[model samples]
Each structure stands twice: as C-alpha cells, then as structure tokens.
Target: MRSTPRKLSLTGLVALTATSALLLTACTDASQSGTDGSTASTDGESSAAPSFDPSTIEVDEAAAALLPEDIASAGVLTVGSNTEYAPAEFIGEDGQTPVGFDIDTIKAVGATLGLEVEIQSADFPAIIPALGTKYDAGISSFTITEERMQEANMISFLNAGSAYAVASGNPDDIDPESLCGVTVAVQTGTIQDEDIAVQSEECEAAGEEAVDILQYESQADATTNLVGGKAQVMYADSPVIGYAVEQTGGQIEQLGDVFDAAPQGIVVAKDATDLAAAIQAALQTLMDDGTLVEVLDGWGSGDAALETAEINPSVG
Candidate 1:
C-alpha cells in the first residue's frame, strides 16, 4: 500500500501544541544565552542585526478611513496565503484550522479594524495573481524583491535569511562553499533560489561542478527529499529550517549561518491603496499593544517579528 502523505491533522495540532509548550518551558528556563554564536561586523564591531523594526512605520487614520467605497461597504478583507510555511503560516494538526504567527498577526489586525478576515490558500507563486478584484491582499511569508515589488505593493513585515539544513550529527558542517558539487534543494522563485544561483556561479568560477540545484514547490517537499537521502542539503529561510529541525526532534541540523537577509511582507494589488493603508494602521496597533510579539511567540517564532511601516510607493 502507498504510504499516506505526511500532513498536519487536528490530532497532530494537539500533540504539536503540547510538545511546543514543553519545549518553550525548557527554552525559557535554560538560562543559556540566546545568541546562536553568530555575529557579523558593523562599524568595526561584531553584532547580530536587530530583527525588522516592527514599529518604524504607521498609517494615517484619515487616509485609512478614505478606503474605497466598495471596500468600506463590504467590511471584509480576503487574504491569500500558503500554509506550507511553518512559523509563518501553517495548518494546525486539525488540518482544516489555520494557525501560525502570520495567521494570528493578521487576525489580530483584522479584529482591531473591525474587518472580517478570510484566508485563501494558494500556491506560493500564485498569491500575487490571486489578489486584485478577487482577493484583497496576500500575507504569505513572501520576501520583498525589486522584481516582485514592480508587480505588487508589499508591506514589510519580518526579516529573514537563507540557511542550510543537513541530517543530524552535521557530518559535513554543510557550508555554502561545501555545497560546491552537491545537490541542494530549494523552493523555486524564492530568495533561497537566488542564493543558490550565486553559489552555483561561485562554484563554476572555482573550477568545481556548479552545485546541482534541485527545485521543489514547497519546503516540505524539499525536506522530504533530504530525509529520503535524495539531496545533501536544503536551502531555505533560517526560521523555516529551525522549525523543521524542531519538528523532527533534532534529526536535522541547520548550518552555515545566515548568508543574506530577505525582508518578508504582505502584498496587495497595485491599486489597493486604501486596503493597504488600513492594514498598515492595524499592524501598528498590534505592534504598540504587544499583540504581534505575543502571537509570534506563541508559534515558537519569537525570532520572526516585524515593525509596522507606512504603505508608500503605491502599487499602481
């Protein structure tokens, strides 16, 4: 018989939550320093970059109130998201229920604005197209890129960076340089994809066979390949790798510290200025009241937090 695909179900949600609570308690009490021993140079001093500024931007209530007449009358906003990204967006063990830092943050924002929020799950790359007349916005763990910014309006949220995951015991200590001739799996069209492309170029320049880059539609797929021994390393966001490692009971180890920072955000149609403004305002309220951090912390993503910022550079 073919085995069933690994999926999160409601029962799994309960188990995961129970496991998370225990892990959180241990983590909180460990007293060990929080730093992962990673540091970078800044003005001759080495320090870790601060997470995204979750409060540096705000929305003008007057402008927000000027939302399109249709939107104001409807009083509901439909958001597009892909639940494959854990800690950002994901389905609870109760497969039908959505739960994650992103879900909580968006729900809290909607509550603050008295707007009904609906989540529509779509493929990661299809989110932008799903917006506009059909969907009002998307809050997937989408990273802001110059190319994508040209197609939609992105409201910056979390700061992320690429990292690699390898089987436990870290047999190779898998650094980017170490990946020269190995097969590395990455999600297509993501910053991790770009990072691998850069690595491939560097490998070619060094006379090594450029790393064999394998593309997967989702992190879970890539991770499956890694566990099945089809791939040597998986390239993805650090937080994502961390979550996967946690879920696997440390069966995997993340290596080669953050290489590049990617700023994640919500995307709206180029013409949804009013909707974007309202969202910006709502996010500000969440930040000020500490609800944003609380929601993220609840999901074991205390590291994936962001500050509110104004919606400038209108989508149109």
Candidate 2:
C-alpha cells in the first residue's frame, strides 16, 4: 500500500464521546507551522543538533537556467501545500504561517532558483489536480505511484515506510498478527486507511470479526485515540509514528517493524515540463550538497532521506 503524510493533531471529532473528545483535544492542539524562515526553526526541529544554515545555500546557475523563461521572470515559485502534515507541512503557532521540513525543502529549492517562494495552504486532496494552474509545484510528501505519474510528474525524493503502534506494553492485548475485531485508528484518506479496509475484508472472508477501523481527520486525533484506550492499534508513516510516539511522551509503543517502504516525491505539473526539470535539477543540487539531508535530519527524518532524486521512477 502507498503511504501518505500523516498530519498529527489531537482534534476532537464531533461524533466521539464527550470524555474522549476532551482527552484527545487536551493532548495536542498545535497545528503545523513554517514560513520563508532564514533560520532553522520548528516546534520540534530545535532538537536536531548543529543547526542548519539556510543562508549558506547558494543559487545553482544551471538549475535556475532550467526554469521556464516566464517563471524566471516572475521571480516567485507558487507552491500549494496542505498545511496539516506535521514535520512536513502544517500551520504554525501563529495559526497562519506554514512550517515544517517540507516547507524548508521547497524554500531551499526556491533559493537555488533565486526566486521567492509563495506557499499557498490548501486541502491535501486539492493540491495535486490544481498543479500548473493553482500552484507551480507541490512537495507535501506525495508518494510516487503509477497512478500519480499519470496525473502529474512525480519527482522521487524521500523513501518512507508504514508502521503500527500500540499502547505501551500492549496493555490492551492488541495483536498485529490478526487485527480481527480490534479497533484500528488511522487518518482519513491515507494508505493505512486503505490497508486496514483490506484487512477488515479478509477477516470477514475468513468468517472472523472484521476490524473496527476508526478514521480520524487528524493523525494526532488517531494517535490520541490509541493513547486514550479508544483504539487497540494505530498505523501511519514511519516518521509520523515516531513523531507521535515522541509527542505522546511514551504513551504508545511501536508494534512490529516498519513495512511497505516506497518513494515519496514532489509533484509537478505534466504540462509544465520545463518547471519540472528545473525543480528536479534544484532538488539534485540539494541532494548532492547535503542540504536535503541536513533539513530532514533536523526533523528526525534523516534516515528516510534519499541520496538521489529521480523523475517518475518506476514504482515496485
């Protein structure tokens, strides 16, 4: 199954019980954040030692030359991102500024092209189809897939996997081997949501109780659900699982190992091939010069960093 960025925030769903709603909301209220910050900063990024220097980034003449002449003249890279995915893209403390590693990555890309980046916050489902029209590019942890390639150019960047987590010591006796009849929490529209649907189907096919899949709009809510004993299990992107585990302060523990690794990419418009080439070139420069790894490392996602960037690579 393909993995998508999980936005962590303990938002209380209206349908939840009054007790759970309070518990979940109280756990995490902050949204994601970032801006055209020249300094290394984030709600969780201060922990990455030896702070990254954005001022040190230099423009790549060849990469800038690849930009479409019109865009080069425009002097701004319009980017649409769903500012909800923590450590990747999300609204910051001020409630409007977009902050996260993904924001920083795109900013570095803009700097290489010597253009200002204008990050436009939009819904996750709306970001892709509007590319080339509504936005110049997208970099919100889009997993490179054959289907996505048909819709837009997918430039490979990071490799990430999915993982499951349960309350510490598995106090609920949750079994990853068979989730039949167990509560499983996942963010809406994520690959984990799709995977759990299949698992639920399998249980019914085998005449066993199907999994009680709990869909939350925010991963923080899902993670909080698991913490509050409302869910027996929860699965998300490996980095997201790690972040949730850390943010929750030992309330949850990883269950089993991470699985289903895949390449996540930056989405560019199909018709804007020139812009796509320019983005790929800027990205390659980042990968080669260590800027990409430095930024990701600060976010605890350095291990998922890719050494090379590719365009529309064949998915396994």
Candidate 1 accuracy as lDDT: 0.59
Question: lDDT of all predictions, in order shown?
Answer: 0.59, 0.70
Candidate 1 lDDT for residue 161: 63
Instruction: Name the runs in model 2 displaced over 4 angstroms.
Output: 1-53
**lDDT by residue for model 1 over 34-118, one digit each (tens)?**
1121111112222221232223334335534756677667877788876656546665554455556666667666666656678
lDDT value for model 2 = 0.70
Give the alpha carbon lDDT tens digit for every residue of 186-267 in model 2.
Answer: 8776778878899999999999999999987655467656766778888777776776565545557788777778888888
Q: What would the TM-scores of all predictions be?
A: 0.75, 0.84
Candidate achieving the largest lDDT: 2
